[model samples]
Target: MLTLQRRQLVGHDILLARHGNHISTMRVDRQAGRVVAYLDDGSVDSAPNLITPGLPMPATVRSVLREDWKFFAVATACTTGFAGVMVAAAVALAGLSGEPGMTQLLSAYSGT
Candidate 1:
């Protein structure tokens, strides 16, 4: 079994466990169900959570969007729809006011 310790100041929960004689400090993410141990060899490895019982490991998401993709897609569609509506309203308002002739532009281009 792994002994759990919380370092609130560092915002990381450290997990300590003994393999044979040497005790290792590791980080246990209960949400992702992942245990990252800093080995004495200076190599980091994702250790198995089997050492920590009563902890159910869930699927880990690599990115934020990968977790809730459906919600993200809906939010994007809603924002795009709102922007399209605003643009449509502006175009309608402009059309209703009628077109303004560009007299200065026409004169400048025609060299009049």
Candidate 2:
């Protein structure tokens, strides 16, 4: 639960190190009188030694958007199209049933 600023050191005062491609929040813990980096992925490293202080953290938001925005956009478009189709189908079914509201929907579901 440490609020780490960009390029901050993973010192004794800091309890976490947010770094890497996945932006993994590594927990800084003292074990056997040594500083350790506990990753959420269940890996551990010697924090003080392995991590270099004041190293610039990568901008994950920009990286993700740049690398994966096309996929995200495609997914969003597909979802929206599917929703539109569903709504249109429902409206058409309701109109065909000659009834309004839930009654039409119920009849359609009942196949009656």
Best-fitting candidate, scored by lDDT: 2
lDDT of 1 by residue, 46-74 (tens): 64455455744344443444768999899
**Model 1 — which ten-residue stretch has the worst lDDT?**
6-15
CA shift of 56, model 1, Å: 4.9
Off by over 4 Å in 1: 1-15, 19-47, 50-65, 99-112
Could you give candidate 2's per-residue lDDT for residues 19-92 as a string of tens digits? Answer: 34432444444353335555557775554622544654555555557878999999999999998998787776
How far in Å is the alpha carbon of 82 misplaced in model 2? 0.5
Per-residue lDDT, model 2, residue 78, is 100
